[model samples]
Target: MSISLLMAVYNPIEYDGRVKRSANALAEICNIKVICPAQDFSSDCFNPDAFDVMRVLSPKIKIQALKQIFFWVNFIFQAIKLRPSIIYAHDYYLIFPAWLAAFMTNAYLVYDAHELIIPNQGERISKRDNFFYFLESRFIKSADLVIAANQERANIMGEHYELKKIPLVVRNIPPMPKQTLSDKLVFRLYEKLEHEYQEDIHIIYMGDINLDRGIGDLINSLKYLPMRYKCILIGGGPSESLIKLSHSQDIIGKRLRLLGPVPHNHIPDLLRQGDIGFLSYSMVGRNNIYCAPNKIYEYAQSGLPIISTSQEPIVSILRKYKIGELLPIKDKNTPLKIAEYIKKISFSNEYKHAIRKFLLDNPHKSEMDKLKDAINGVIN
Candidate 1:
């Protein structure tokens, strides 16, 4: 079987978790080829060595109106040349072009939606969003399969698009750990925390950090926390909202440290060092409300409890599994609760096992089997 997965992103595929996992899994049954924009596409540990990578440059992101037009033209040519049995579009942005390619070539079309293309992403709806919504409504049903990151996202897409078939929920979970946990490393980490800074709590927030993810509120909360409590935010994004915290004592490197993005492989080890993880996204848009973020799975896999907001999708899981604590995002007492959770959290072996077991029960193995079946079904 042959499948061409189109991921229209400026981001390199090496860093994209969902695409990486889907490609690696599909490689078992098909010759998986990834199509991306002109960007770095280095193969990392996540790659399965069964796929060829192709790059094309059509529309630079700066020009808004030209993106879809260029994409359709550029993609149709590639689809004809590749002659794949299935044209799998990684998200809704490229679905129109993917559908066109599949239609022209008689290839099966699949829509793998990582997020909702919600109307009014930037606080309000513009002409572009309206146009996108119109296209989505008109063309999305052409896809043979619609896969979403979660059931909530799937339901929204079904209702909003008025599609007859619901999307399948394939969560963006990390691959199981390959390295064995070392007793020496575990003892050293425990000893360092127990003896070095017994009074202080070290917390970490790893992933794309922006104002909406509550980086501002996280920093502001630091001011209210005791001096012994320090936090390290472990990624990069728009830093305009974080500028005010520059003068604060936290940013002086004593209490707060901003380490820019590291290699994806280093995340588990990074999580091991932190006492708690933060998934503090603001529920401003439908995308945010329905988001089933991968960070929670990553944090729990590394044996760290999470601190998140009482939002729709994330709240349900965290509350159900008891793997994390949920709090109001912007309340006066939010910081107080954060500090108390840090101070009171019991990072015991039994608790970590429970979190791991919950994840194992809903492991990413199903993703591979389901994805393989879809591709095979289309090919046969």
Candidate 2:
């Protein structure tokens, strides 16, 4: 039996590195295919060799409604062609199309809830958002099996739907490969950065660069630190405006470098060059609070101690494992507290040892086993 994963994305090229790793790992055990709709742009970054890549040709529509219709039309056409035993929809938007196809083809439908799709009713939800939530809840409750990114997200969905079995929590963790950076590649990157800027401690952030990602706070915090501290913003989002603002604020040009969106595979080498890795998001919603971001695990695997906010499972993991430090997201002195924590960890061998041990352990083996069981459950 084969499984097809349908994923809705802004940039289909920007496959979550952890998800790709998990997909590749899962492919080792099962026949798997990935189906994604065409976005405004395309890239060769996706690994065509790992899984069959099925792309639906749809015109780029700015309106969300039109985009949804276009995607569904192409998805239905493709689904008819590749009749897999099971269909796994990555997010709510992809679920409706998969449901339509499943009904016609009589295939098992699986909902992979990566985030809290239903918006808080109390908050201002647009009419379109409300309709999507209604469809999501109905289809999710109807799916043969459900998969959630974290326990908290599963709980939220359970509150709204009557699901007999609890959705399986598949934590987004990176597969730890026993590989080392070649000294030549390491030294070359080091020399390149050194030539561009002074030899200083390079702190790296490698995910979406949005307002809620705390980029402003990060840049503000840098102002309080010494000139020896440098930051490399290695992703793209609405917050690229902060780059110009950083320059206008007279934050050292050499200290803050914005290398716009590098390919996902290239991130590990970048993380290796950094003194510390950072993952901070404002806990504005339940989704943000419960996020088990891929970068956190990547940082841990790279043996870099992290500075993060007191969010859900991440905060619990950091505190319990003694692997990193967490600051209050809303605290007025958050930037200062983060800076102090960085200073402490940078100088402490104990913290470094904790991070090293965490990496050496590679705690995601059990999580991957759980994922494997979930996939098997759907098939068997």
Candidate 3:
């Protein structure tokens, strides 16, 4: 007998790697159904037969806050109608509504928190964050189960909520299927560069480009780097302006290649073209240190060494795995230090292949199984 599980997610079906993996895993034991935003509904990962996706019209630019309001109103009603065995909420905003739906239908409630939403030391916590924290705490206190993306965040949630048990840590990692780089893709990225950059070391930073994500720092630091060291930023965000600024500059202009946002499915192939992956989030708060971003896995999967700031968990992972070096964050000299570090390292094709194998082998399906079991354990 198959049980019914309802997943309420805010993102489109095409992306959301974490949700896609979780849904596929849950489908093994449940009749999986998804309620997601109608925009960008095309998906490459999901099997249409195994799951049914209900599309809801998401609010556009106007009255953006009302979007959540509209979604919850629709979600709670749908949850009640579906009467699923479980209501899995992907965002904190949906937690309260999912809890209410679970209460109304006697279904298990699961909250999947991807980050440390609460502010850490030295960071400003606005009234809006406070209000959401109140709702998040309420859900943590009342929900049948809560899952954080990392162990540190799980501990933080437990301490802050004063809960008897810590939330389970289910990190947002991609599946390890040993993907092969396409022959055509081997030179497409290099073809974008001018003849001068044919010999440059192609450093890439592929993800959300924003202030907190250290895009400004990454671009500005390139000025100190050698002319032969080039950077390709392969993502878009509110910080597109920063990229424009870098593009307009005379000194670092030619070296910086800003590309449009690549879809999640094509990211791995794109990442394979880079010499190194850059990850440098400004550490204004513990969230930056405690959180684990998907790029770490993506970089390793691409067999690219990383030039990253010493963020916790990420730092530990890098050091343990020996995949890359942490860029020393000394002010005024950080760029020079990064340049120096990159210049010193060398990797051969043999070593690159080994790194890719290590990445694929390191914590594969077993970790995902543990995550799947954590959710199913709630029913037991």
Candidate 4:
């Protein structure tokens, strides 16, 4: 019989890089179908290539707990009918239903633990997250395969849940770029920014924009840096807060360009134009302390030297690869330190050879093979 894989996630599939990458990789070995929440009513019938999508438009329930139950119930019913050879749960929230569906259908179950806690506001476990954590602890044991987004996460999950084995590590790095910054692509925004900031050293950040992400400190650092230094944020999150942070520095539109979120395919082109990659995850939660941010690889692949906080895997990567500098976390003078470091490495070409060598040594295709191997191992 032909193999079939059913993947479940609670977010809009388009915005979820891990789900997109994993589904595409797994598609090679099994017919893939994804069940995710629709972005809105407009995306209810949305479809993408390689795999079929089943987007559930959440019901209009005022109570948060009841609404979640409604979504889980829908996922279970839809997943059971498909009788997939493998049932993959992408988030902790879907573990209960995805586990139940796998039990009902006798399908091999895969739990892709994408986050330590739902929302992960801080170090403390909220009441809501406690329930989900309990579910994962209970149901994850039954999964035929468990996948962690990063190595540190896998280690933590194994210890946290006391699993028989650690989940497979799959770094969420983007595929090798088909086009580079020098390539003749018709991207008008990139062209315009390159022209406008030709003399400036661009510090590029492409991820969620929020206070917890240290966007405020990054923007404030502009005050210490010279006028030739610029910041470009390319992801979506509270624009008003970002705007407020930019106002005092008087660099919102000029030195700081909040480009918002762009298509995943467009990142390589946009990133290649930058001189440095900026990552500043606040060390408040377990997730932040043990983050395996893909921006390191993304920046390295694009040949941009990184400047980030001293988070675990990031610190280790920077130390090992010598691709960038690490700032002290939670220091009040972080912005000034970022500026100092930026000035220090403004013209250094030392990282160019290292970045080039690293990308050649480690490519996203290798990770894809690992994911495929994990799935195939379970199937066989």
Candidate 5:
């Protein structure tokens, strides 16, 4: 049977590992066509031969609110034209429009809740979040299937929406590496580290470099750490604050090197060179508290022991796997605590063993299987 799956996301599908992974996995059982905002769409983002791509062009609306309104409407109209067997909404922003398109097309609607729309921890929900929540609560039950990144978020959504079933958990793990870090790559990395940074203990933070992800804390922690301890922040975001913080701490380039964003393909190799993986998301918002970040899986996959904030799903993973240390992100002392923990855990063999065990048990293939099974059950 030939099945055509249509996926719609407000963000570019290429940079989103969850959507890309889902698209790639669904291709195993069906034809795939992805719909994304045309403003920043790149053909190089995905292999055109594997699946189809459609970019939604928005009218030039000067007002930001009006622009977004046009974008989603265009997105919905585009999805309807394809007449896919499954209409997969990647985020809450697209949930209602996707529902509408699916209803018009008579397609099986799948709502993938990447994060909790409601603020769980009493953080003020913005007008935009409020709107998305409205869309989600209204049409969520109409979905034939719902997916979440982790079980905790799935339970929250199911209870919040009063759904008959909890959303399926599809983790955002990368595909298993075909090869470990090449000796040449390691040698080149070490040569630079040893020569420039005088190489002691490397703390690596990959993904969005922003205050929300605790980049500020990480930067502050560097001052408390010895000169031998250095941090390499990968990825790109608002860097003015981060740059100023690093400079004020007197660690910019000297101890903390912001390499900006690298291509996703280079992450595994680059991350493998690090001594410790840093995963810190501020616990101010419900989404942050319940976040099942892909960086944890990426860090473990690269064989680095982690030092992370104490948050749900993350705390559970670390505690269960015994792969890393978790600290509460609550006061000024937090950075000092992170620095001390890094010193204690650096080059430890125990965490390495735990990471190996974790990798052996969990792979992206299994997560892909879970996603495939869930969708197949609905479509078949």
Candidate 6:
């Protein structure tokens, strides 16, 4: 039976590891239809053929309320036109529309909760969110199946509702490619960086560089590092101001590279040259504490030693593998401590080999299999 997948996300085409992987995996089992919002209505990134396997389109709308209304109307109209056997909503924004559409069409509704919607991190739960949470509770009771990105999220749902809902844990882990870049391309990229600072130990940071992401601490920590190590801040967010702070400190001229944002495909090759990887988001909320970010797996896949804050799942994994350093978030000399830690890890062959082996052995295969089975069972 064919299944329609509805997602409410910002940019679906850019190589967001989780979204792309999930979309591709779903397409393997069913006729997938992804509906998302478009920043620019004319952008061709939403072209269905670009993904090669699914039908993707932007339900063009400007405001949030209007978007929600249009989405349900369009989804119901499309359900009648396409005749999908089941409907799946990826996150909260798509939930109401999918729920209404499924009810009208008598189709099974699958809700994929990538994060905790009500008590989310970084944003306060306002009256609007509380009201939505009440509706979300009802929707969960009504959904055919519920999928969460991690165990912590599943537990959150269990705390609030008591339905016969089976929560499937579908982690946002990326598949690591076995092949490395060609020597020629690596050399070319290395040469570009070499032109700037030949002696600097390059450290790489990717993903949203927001305030909660600990970019400020990371920049401040740079002062504690030895003169030979330089930091590269990739991706965009509030870190742009931190980049400026680095400049005022005279570190930006030679010791810092702020490449605002790059394409996701370019990240692997970019990571290859870096001596270390960093994922240092602040653990201020339940979502932050429980996050098993894609970057953690990405760093492992890239064979780079990671430096992260001692958050729950990340600290647990880092300590378990002994491949990365989990430092206290509020240490006064955090930058120096991190620098020293990096220096130690950079020279350790044993740690490097062990991490690479662990990544290869795990490879997120079991997680993907479980998710595939759960989705298949629900849709069937």
lDDT string for model 1 (73-115, tens) is 7778888887777888876577778878888888888888776
Model 6, stretches more than 4 Å misplaced?
A: 1-11, 39-62, 120-124, 163-166, 178-192, 195-199
Task: State the lDDT of candidate 4 residue by residue for 1-380, as single tens digits.
Answer: 28899899888887777888888888888999898877764733435678898878788778978877877888888877889899999988888898899989999999988886633434477788788888988998898888887888898888777889998998877777777335356256554346364588889988888877887888888998878888888889877878987886688888998787677677888887788899878777777888877778888888888899898888887788888899985688988988888887787888887788778777889999999999989999
lDDT against the true structure, per candidate, is: 0.71, 0.72, 0.75, 0.82, 0.81, 0.70
Show model 3 residue runs off by greater than 4 Å: 40-49, 59-61, 121-123, 177-181, 185-198, 239-253, 347-361
Measured by lDDT, the strongest candidate is: 4
Tens digits of lDDT, candidate 6, 1-380: 34555443334545455666766676666666665544443433534442332323445556766656665566667766665667777667667777887887788888877667656545667787776777787677788888887776787777667756548778777887554566467557554344245566777888787756776666776787777777777787766577667777888757777777665666777777777898877666666777768887878787888888887778767777887888886788777777777788767776687787668666677777776788778766
TM-score of 6: 0.86
Q: Runs in model 4 with CA error above 4 Å?
A: 41-47, 118-123, 180-192
Give candidate 5's total backbone clashes.
0
C-alpha root-mean-square deviation, candidate 6: 3.4
TM-score of each: 0.86, 0.88, 0.88, 0.91, 0.91, 0.86
User: Higher TM-score: candidate 5 or 6?
Assistant: 5
Estimate candidate 4's alpha-carbon lDDT, on a 0 to 1 scale. 0.82
Question: Per-prediction count of colliding residue pairs?
Answer: 0, 0, 0, 0, 0, 1
RMSD of 4: 2.9
Tell how far residue 82 is off in model 2, in angstroms: 2.8
Give the better candidate number (4 or 6) by lDDT: 4
Inter-residue clash pairs, candidate 2:
none
Model 5 agreement with the true structure over 1-380: per-residue lDDT tens digits: 37888888887666788888888888889888888877454545655566787776666667877766776787677767778898998888888888888989999999988878776556577787788788888999999999988888888888877889988888878886555558587556544333244457888988777887787877787777777888888888888888888777677778877777666666777776688999888777778888888888888887888989889889898999999999875766878888888977884689988988898888889999998899889977
Question: Could you give the candidate ranking by lDDT, starting with the highest?
Answer: 4, 5, 3, 2, 1, 6
Task: Give a tens-digit lDDT track for model 3, residues 1-380.
Answer: 35789998876766678878788777778888898877644444344566788878876757867887888888899988989999999877677888899999999988888657877656678887777777887777777788888888888889988977898877767775344546465356445433354567878888777756766766776776778877787777886577566757664457877676765666776776678888877776667768678778778777787778888878777766667778655566676767766665443344365566557666657657876787678878
State the displacement of the C-alpha of residue 139, model 3, in Å, after optimal TM-score superposition. Answer: 1.8
lDDT of 2 by residue, 1-380 (tens): 34554433323634655456556666766667776665455555465576665666667567867877887777777667777676667766777888888887777887777677666657777687678788887787778888888788787777768778878888787776444556467556544344244447777887788756786777777777888888778788876578677877787457777776765666676677777888887676677877868777888887788888778878777877788888775788877887787777778777667877666665777777887777777777
- TM accuracy, model 3: 0.88
Clashing pairs in 1: none
